[model samples]
Target: MDIVNALALFANFVAVPATAYGAQLALGALGVTLIFGILRFANFSHGELMSFGAMATILVTWTLQDLGIGIAPFPTALLALPVGILASIAVSLATNRMVFRFYQRRRANPIVFAIVSVGVMFVMAGLIRIIIGPDDQSFADGERFLITAFEFQKATGLKEGIAIKQTQVITVVVALVVVAALFWFLRKTRAGKAMRAFSDEEDLALLSGVNPDRVVQIAWIITATLACIAGTLYGLDKTYKPFIFLQILLPIFAATIVGGIGQPVGAILGGFVIAYSEVMVTYAFKKVITYLSPTDWAPEGLVQLLSTDYKFAVSFIILVAVLLIRPTGIIRGKVI
Candidate 1:
């Protein structure tokens, strides 16, 4: 029973939360990978795009709530998601037409495009900040816990109890559904094939009668949809803050690079790897250790590898190591 308690404790603090976070990161990384794989540039504005989407969702959720609308057991944000996605798509299209397309037409270098994206990042960031203000906004509604610790303890009769959040389950479920749909679309759809062909060889795809403009439009639209879903889910799971997205960008990039840039499967794998690493490294193991130890013994220290505040540093270290040792990542994906 002590062993069971230990496992329960570990799951409560580390496993469940990490899994949800991993799913969120995977979605964000997929958007980044898609843009890079197709457009051939690192988009520095992706984080701000996420912020904008989440901001839009939050605003719409607030409006819906004021209008006495809700889904109850689920967040109202779900109902507002479509509106947010549309807003994000509009901004993304406008950005492509007004900013990125200019560079594309001029045949700018990838580095130039990356720098331009940074400029766009600042602009989006400022806009989001102006709209949402620089503070954490809580918009989550409906059920908070799928399984509370007390309920779990009563059911299992274990000293340690696991608590699971509804948002965590939703994040994982939605991410799986979205990823499945994306993979299917890529494998079976016409536009997906065109996008893949364009990514592989632009000239060849054009000669094969693929429409570059349509492909580019589709990529941005898909990316915006992904960013909105990921952002809204993340905000629901955690809290919506204008600055958190910027901080999250590092881990998203790390996940993309570690999994192998341009490899969707790699992005998913890398997200979990990075999530588990950050969680396990920072998590205090004293409780689990105490539960597993002999009857009267206990450790004095927290037995944590690092503090929670340094979690992002773990991603950075892993990213650097991967870049130095295996630039192509775990799956030998395209080198950036």
Candidate 2:
């Protein structure tokens, strides 16, 4: 029973939430990695891009709810997700046309592009706050949980049982599907092949008649699509707040770098690693330990390695460590 309770506590505090968070981070990091591999610049504006998408989804979902539309057991935001994706695509295209294209034409240095993206980041970040405000918005609707804690314990007739949220399951499932589709698109499509060729050898790709503009357009579209999906999932799992997306930028970047800056597999791998570390390090294991310990033998301390207030600090520490210790990332130099 003690062992079971200990396992349940671990599942409740660390496994479930971290997995959902990791899935969200992985999707965001994938977009970042894709941009790094293909477009060759750190897209500092992606956080705002994500915020914009979530805002779009939330607004549309509200409108739909007001109109008496809902999916009952699942969130209506799922249905409204495409609207957010479309809005994000529009923003991405407009940004690329009005901003990034000039730099691309000039063949500017990557750092120059990075600086420009920083400026765009501020503008977009401000625009999202103006549209959505800086307050937390609850956009979730329908059934909130696949199983409640008490229900799970009752059903299992156990001292401890793990509860799983509907959003968490949905997030993981959606992320898996999206990743699979993306991998398929990249591996088996002509356009994806062209993009890969461009990323691999730009001069040769141009010589091979791959249109640069087409590639750029596709990259922006995919990045925006990814941003929307990730943002919407995150908002549904947590809550929608403009500023939170800005903070999320740190973990997404940390994941991308830890997985390997230009590697998709690395990005996904890095997200889970960072998420688990954050959760495990910050979580208090006192109750679980008490359950597992003999009578009056439990430790007195909280059994937490770090306070939850410093969760994001874990990502920062990991990011700095990775930069100093393994600049090539955990996966070595796999570019894409």
Candidate 3:
């Protein structure tokens, strides 16, 4: 049994997947947080928006592949990102104008808005399934690995090797860039300040000359952009399936709640926390144990807290815990 081997295996199982998954969750959580801040409600439709974005990117990637305009160092989906984001923004704006706008005009309660979002979710889900045929599709292409395990082993002359996938690297880079840009926009720009002011006090913001309708419109567009980027990156790293995005709702909700709804920084942290917890708890640790333990001391059973099938349950448990202990969330987000 070697401690070095055990650490290596643990790093592979817990660290790598956690970082990758954390990025995806962070992206999703950002969208949820933005909507909560500006729209003043929990948008249940966000999961489907992400699905729609991913589906759009997948379709575009397929088209590009057919046209033989493939990316070499990155996935073709990366090239299709701007188009997918634009399409998502357009769809979101249209939905707001046609559906949610009515409710806003009526000055509907937050609960009513939540219910409306649910209806929108269903519609978007159906549309995605119809367009994508309810099947799983891989959108990843070009360089698969940034650093292959064999290459690492040969270079370092170590028994253990590290393999970093190109998609994983790209996902992290893109998320960082997007997040930085978002923060800059929110903190530095006049529209961003107006958005914050609106979130702080809608009536006051209106009195201060901020156009309520315009703020709502901008929020929807920004939320849609975030969803598109998050969804596309997740699809590139994993496979694109309309149903999987639906399943992502729980974790995204958990992250939003844990971080304190409407707090962007908290959302990011919550995303990473939830992602690591899920991956670490569900991941089988047999390989890690075998690498570390002596033959006689190794356990017979797999060292996993729960099966992957119960991942959603894990998120729900966390959500319940947070609600019971601190309903306002870690950052004390707006109760509304």
Q: What's the alpha carbon RMSD for model 3? A: 1.7
Ranking by lDDT: 1, 2, 3
Cα-lDDT of candidate 3: 0.88
What would the TM-score be for candidate 2 when compared with the true structure?
0.96
Tens digit of lDDT per residue, candidate 3, span 1-336? 787767766776688878988999999999999988987788999999999988888889999999999768778888998899999999999999999999987878889999999999999999998888888888788999988888977887767777888988888899899999999988999999999999888889999999888989988988999999899888888878888887898899999999899999989998998998899889988878777767747667988899999988887888899899998888889765
Residue range 217-311, candidate 1, lDDT tens digits: 88999999999999999999989998889899999999999999988899999999899999999999998999999785778999998999899
TM-score of each: 0.97, 0.96, 0.95
Better candidate number, 1 or 2, judged by lDDT:
1
Q: For model 2, how does the per-residue alpha-carbon lDDT over 224-328 read when each residue is reduced to its tens digit? A: 999999999999999888888889999999999999987788999999988999998999988888888877577789999999999999999998998899988
Q: Which stretches in model 1 have alpha-carbon errors above 4 Å?
A: none
Worst 10 residues of 1 by lDDT: 1-10
Query: Which parts of model 2 are misplaced by more than 4 Å?
Result: 294-296, 334-336
The Cα error of candidate 3 at residue 37, in Å, is 1.0
> Relative to the unseen true structure, what is the C-alpha lDDT of residue 208 in candidate 2, on a scale of 0 to 100?
100
